[model samples]
Target chain A: MTDLNNQPQQPQKEQPGDQPKKSELVEKIQQLGQSNVAQAPDSNIHVLPIIGQVEGHMQLPPQNKTTKYEHLIPQLVAIEQNPKIEGLIVLLNTVGGDVEAGLAISEMIASLSKPTASIVLGGGHSIGVPIAVSTNHSFITETATMTIHPIRMTGLVIGVPQTFEYMDKMQDRVVNFVTQHSNIDEDKFKELMFAKGNLTRDIGTNVVGQDAVDYGLIDAVGGVKEAMEKLNEEIDKRKPDEDEQVIQ
Target chain B: MVLYTPLSEVDIFPADQTAYDSTVITTYNQTPVKAFKLENGSYQIVQVLSTDPSIYLHPDYQPGMQFNA
Candidate 1:
């Protein structure tokens, strides 16, 4: 078996004109620890990572890692426009940032024609909750946690009462999005958001893997393997419709 | 100014804006990437910002790879 595998690679390496190519291949294997397999230029399943902080209007400092809306919005538009891209898998590991930005991303993902599956790996806190549930299906690892919290603002507050109402509206938007997208209801979600003892000195609940599923916040408890399986299944389900359209 | 996050505002926002000016977003092989300009005038990849899954598979496009042109 080993000899047969080696036989096909021998000629390509020994050809006089192929010397430069051979060295490049060797370097690639040495550096990446694997030979680069010939894959189609377009990918049917594209992964969009919602990692670090979801940056919005403010430009975060260079030291901080963030997922900028400008980059993601255009990429998402491209993914939707590209016929080759059939499925989207959103990988979430975000601490959450601006409310509007996070919601904008969630809305875009929710509106995509292609099937999507989101897997919350680490902590998908605050605004990430909406984005996580915005997909066709969502997953969370056994250790992953989702923090359900109310919207808050820091720094100076000129009108405390009006600010509270504005924050309430913002919080309602997130709640409405999550409740509409996922299996969780408004009452239960609000309960989780206002739960007192779950987080010390904080007014929200940090829901762990299975608990999130129990609360109907996430679809299931799983990682990449399960998320990919779900995505492939959804993609396959959509294939027939596309084929029917082609036939017509 | 209205940051909604579980993390402290101080930890999220830096006091100095000049520190962020060193990096720039440019295209490498038709893919958008965030890179830093080295002293030698070459760019080093900081992040591969492409939605194409195959782009990430390329060894040269990986983070920290010295991208020429």
Candidate 2:
């Protein structure tokens, strides 16, 4: 009978490329253990960049390029938790992605205790508008443009009453969020969102930076300097009066 | 949960006609207005009013007025 318990053991060997130098392996492990904490002072405001598409939904197919909110949500929580972080500056330059993810991010920023400001760079289109205005104050580059449009679905639309009702409810939620955060009136925003003769093919209005300011969609038509200054002012106002020192 | 309402419904706007000359007509106790020139050689006037802090404040504050500690 074959001895089942006495199995032959194979000799252990490492290939030339597979064997890393002892120091190199130790160094890599050490680096991996180090945390990548942002080192901005508590008094100094930190800028968190939220670029690219906001990702939502599980099982993201290859065709669906989205901005992962999981990564962003933790970063936002970190900003709120960090004692050294006085304020947060959100720099947005996105071609808008997932709606639920974007809205979730916006709500998080809006509810943060720290003074937050957002600057819309190249463009703050679609769901980006709510995020742009979600901060305590918001600014856009003079050249930046914001596209105010209704919610859209990329997949096939079932032409059923329930489908239409769901779409309407979803749209209402977005519109409510945007109007609540920004100065844009809901009716005018709706008009722009469903404008008949704005774009030849699209069903929305593209407001440039200054126009956005005029429409109350954005606070100012300025860049980094203006946004930072506003954020600092808000932060200063929130600080305890006893701790306030007059700066020359 | 607090239901969300549109600002347009809560806020009021001016409703008056202007003469050929570019002068804004206003009623007593009306909100101030800021005027801007549109691209089509037409002027668009927007009412400038202070937003109630309640609109944007965290729910811990009073129902009306700006949130002041």
Candidate 3:
């Protein structure tokens, strides 16, 4: 092998007076060809994972793994416009963050004309409540949990009754949206929000798995397999309506 | 050149979708297997690339020798 290394390498036939940089460009192209990410997007169902904390306008530290709303917004637009995509599956496993940003995402998903479904894994706490309910159908794993709590601000406030009123209005938006989207009623949900002993050191209820379904916050208690089947069934139902539109 | 690396370090699904269209997955036994999603949207192995010469040649191999030896 050492003798082979010592042997003078065979020279390649050069294409008439190519610059060294041009040969370097050729190498770069070859490297790009081997990457799986560079391939054209395919597949009918897109899985959008809402993992970690949902970062709003403020950038979280680099150490934090966040599903930035900006990244998701554009992808959601693409998913809406792209005719190739037939359905969407949102998988949520978030500690949840940023009220405004989370609300924005939930609104966009609720307004999408395409068939959509969501499955909550682990804990969908804080503002994640609205997002999980926004989908056409929702599922939560039997072990998954959801925290129903009032809105909170981290920064300085005027500390007045007016500030309290403003917080109350914002909290209403979240409560109203969740109730409207899911089977849960407004009064019952608020009852859960102010429930006692469910969470220590907090004033809210931490609804678990089947408890969530029983409360009608989530449509069912299931995992990925069940969620996919539900999404596909919804997609199939929408097909005839689309074909009818084309005929007219 | 052949690179011997663990599967965990390399991301098999770099794209956004849960199911890949047709990404060839190479196994521990040095078998290169191709998979495709079915009509029902489940994946099944479509081909085994055993006939093709491996792009990766084990560096420590010798004739009539066990891999562990």
TM-score of each: 0.82, 0.61, 0.64
DockQ of 3: 0.02
Ranking 1 against 3 by DockQ, winner: 1
Docking class of 2: incorrect
Per-residue lDDT for A128-231 in model 3, tens only? 88999999999999999999987777645787999999989999999989999999999999998988887887788998999999999999999989988998
In model 3, what is the error at residue A238, expressed in angstroms? 1.8
Query: Could you tell me the lDDT of residue B62 within candidate 1?
Result: 63
Query: Residue A85 in model 2: shift from native, Å?
Result: 0.8
Query: DockQ, per-model, please?
Result: 0.30, 0.01, 0.02
Number of the top-ranking candidate, with lDDT as the measure: 1
- Best-fitting candidate, measured by DockQ? 1
Docking quality level of the chain pair in candidate 3: incorrect
Q: Report how far residue A149 has shifted in candidate 3, in Å.
A: 1.1
TM-score of 2: 0.61
lDDT of 1 by residue, A100-201 (tens): 999999999999999999999999999899999999999999999989899876555777688888888998899899999999899999999998988999
The TM-score of candidate 2's chain A against the true chain A comes to 0.77
Q: On residues A1-248, what C-alpha lDDT tens digit does candidate 2 reach at each position? A: 11113434435566676654664446444533322222321235756566666666732432333456765676677668867668888888877766888899899899999888899999888888888989989999989988888887654467799998998998898899989998989999999999977778879998898999999989898888998888878888877786345543
Tens-digit lDDT track of model 3 for B1-69: 564543322133234343343432333133333444445643344333221112122211111111110
